[model samples]
Target: MGISPLNCGWGICVFLSLCLISFTPPCDGGNILVYPVDGSHWINMKVLIEELHARGHNITVIRASTSLYIKEKSPLYKSITIELDKKVEPFFIQYLQKHIKAQVEGASAFTFFKITLGFVSAFSQLHLLMCDYLAQTLDDPTMVKSLRDSQFDLVLTDPAIAPGVILAKYLELPLVFNVRWITGGEGHFAIAPSPLSYIPVPRSGLTDKMNFIERVRNVFFYSIALLQQRLIGPHYDAICEKYIEGGCDIISLLQEADIWLFRSDFVFDFPRPTMPNIVYIGGFQCKPAQPLPVELEDFVQGAGEHGVIIMTLGTLVYDLPKEVSDAIASVFAKMPQKVIWRYKGKRPSTLGNNTLLVDWMPQKDLLGHPLTKVFVAHGGTNGVQEAIYYGVPVLGIPLFFDQYDNLLRLQQRGAGKILHLSEISQCFEQSLMEVLHQDSYRQNMQRLSDLHRDQPVAPMDQAVFWVEYVMRHKGAAHLRTEAYKMPWYSYYCLDVVLLLLAAVTLLLLSTVTMFRFLCYRCLRKPKAKQH
Candidate 1:
């Protein structure tokens, strides 16, 4: 009589339930599809992908054959490479090379537009080629069937490229954007509120706090960007229609994105309005510096108390003009500090005894080294972020794109100085001396570094958490604002303005008619009496 059959059955049921709960694995992270704009973007996103993989998410990367530099051989992730038209790759490279040369030579204002239009034309050609290839792939019954079978959870892509949005629409998956630059263009503003009065346009070379003239200039730049977007946007829409069942606009798709992971932090960027869906995960790709190669380590150590200076112009800028190279070498020759320059071009005839020129260098590692004194760079966003991360002062020689704006921000922070290529021959030594001899530059950079590092969770961890959050919640719809769904006129309240103006006009017209009738009545009585 110790236990009845019913009691035993109840106990057995409870035991089995507890066992089931205990053995059940944590929610498996969802399948993620990553489509980066280029090799550089892939490099920036590599850390985030690896973190997601570690968390048990299935990751698939779709890259163009021309951009397969980061070969993912990991068992955790898979990669699919698509080939572009034969002519596209070579033509793109040639166009970029020509533009870089013109930029370095300080192309005239008229030539600048000519160069810009040429680049845009080349980009459009390549874009059309990619679109055609994608259309062909998606049109194939087998390929479409295979993709539908995969049942992807979400698409993480660079929205800077229009094709990414098209791919997302074709797959019928939630989209999450990964923007490598701080200033996302007009499409970003449409999704999030960025007041033009305060927030400077990207590449405008203006700061957050602006004068009247600066504000006007910002608006002008924004208007130009809008015009350009309008002109080129229709082509993208047409291309997207060919692949996806229901044609979608790139901007509309972007507005519906689950979240935006921006490669920027407030510590380095000016404070601006942001929507709930925008997440700043800057410096997630950065890691503690690895040990340098023995030869490089020896050279760095050999400088002794004099220290070393690191110089690089980023991956795209392979070389400098001979005269520019000569001028830079001449300045380095007089310095006591050792210089390690990354140069892929011809050896400078005036190469200094204290300078060691190499075709490639581990830039982040060099910046993190204790012996490194200052960074002389092209002011690319990645390089500037690395410099700030390591608390190294910069002497930036920005050429084009957002480089000028990046340097401008750095200079504003008192952590760096801008050295324009046009004035480099004359100001190279002076700017170099200022960054090296001035204590303020180093001190300011160190403070920013501290702020950047003093977070509850690491940037990489934060990024991984948010990415998984969106997946678990299925697009994070709660984070999206109603602004995305609103039309331009409605958001700006143009209709309200029109209503108020109409009311005022009607009132004024009625009062004027009444005044005229009173005047005629009074004057007509006097005229009748005289007659």
Candidate 2:
């Protein structure tokens, strides 16, 4: 029998609908407002921004007028510029150079104090400057009204500074963090339970396994971190009080973030307690190596069986002290491996024929090259992570900040060696040789690489998924804990402990009193009968 016309039309409609639904994505474009820290931090943030752009999210970046790495114009995102007095990054870079020089000279008590004081003062001022910028931005009705009217779906930021956190709260937007450091300390401490017994503090230069002495040292390191929180947080507190609805501390604001795309994984980071909301996106910036430029590829090919070694101190450090540079050059001279050193300083007199000095090189490409043997580095997170991604053993010359601590983790894992600045001249060549010849170094690193790559989803894809999840759900409040809202005593269960202790004490005292009364009654009756 022939099908009815009405039934055939209904069947066609159903088929087309299913096809459309199958083709559509689960999540669509979202309007994202990003507040990012400049310089090296921007490098990582830009990668995420680009990925989001490709995924069809509309991104608006709020940047300072004097921002270093963040340009006013970008194809990836629109810019909401905030005015500032002077450039902060250059000042920070200058301070780091001075600090590196101080470190290389020696670690006397006076030098330590001077360096610490200088660094703390610089960072404190930077935070205060951001607070001022935030104030200026909020105080302007035009800016505030524009922000509110934009109707951004979410606020993405690096919580290393507080303006972004406060702004996100003010706008009543779901917040997400691309974070490693918050002003108070490492991002993990800002939310997670970090027991100093096993979780070593960042820049602490200590390992996860600690002896009694090391535990004491960890406590001392934690004290410094607390001191930093105390020193740096007040400027932000005032801003929060003025702007946020009920007022909040910097840590509280950080904790409210719906998602944290953390930069380090177990490969580079020690295993520690982590929160459900924080997703590890370690090596998200890493990918298969691209083709090297003709010159670099030729140099690598020339190395033959001897292989190549590449060194870069990241963007922050360019010029080492003359003597230190000379010492490094002398050490590289005797090595059979070809060296590609990214040095912006004047040529060292002891420079070797095998070493190729350039203003910059494709670090990822070189590290991924089959001929590259060892990475000589200053232990920056970016380089360290890339080293893990490529399974290259590192011979580190740690200069400042978290450099030594980063290299120290690799040392503990048997993947790298740290040659301190003081010991560099005497031991640099030998350390390089050890890492070059040691099969164990490469093996351990390759093992880490395998584990890091064994994830069910790539780190970048995971990061994108969570970001889209936040956008799709409005916010992941179900996943977020109420612990941040509780007082310290309540959060730690100290109050409950105290209450239990008091109840137990009361019960014990009552029992003792009752026993005494019964004894007294028995003894009194016996005495009366005897009389």
Candidate 1: RMSD to truth: 6.4
lDDT of 2 by residue, 1-531 (tens): 999999999999999999997552478789999999998889999999999999899999999898878999999999999888788868778777777777677668688778787788878988998899999999999999999999999999999887899999999999999989899778888788899999998777898999999999899888998998898999999998888778888888888899999999987888899889999999999999999999788888888999999988888777788888999999889888889999998899899999999988889988999999999998988889999999999988887777888899899999999887878778888888899999999999998888888998899998998999999899998878888888889998999999999999999999999999999988885434553
lDDT of 1 by residue, 182-221 (tens): 1125344667678889888876889999999999999988
Instruction: Estimate the TM-score of every prediction.
Output: 0.88, 0.93
Steric clash pairs (candidate 2): none
Worst 10 residues of 1 by lDDT: 180-189
- Scored against the true structure, residue 239 in model 2 reaches a CA lDDT of 94
Point out where model 2 deviates above 4 Å.
1-25, 525-531
> What clash pairs does model 1 have?
none
lDDT of every predicted structure (CA atoms): 0.79, 0.89
Best by lDDT, which number? Answer: 2
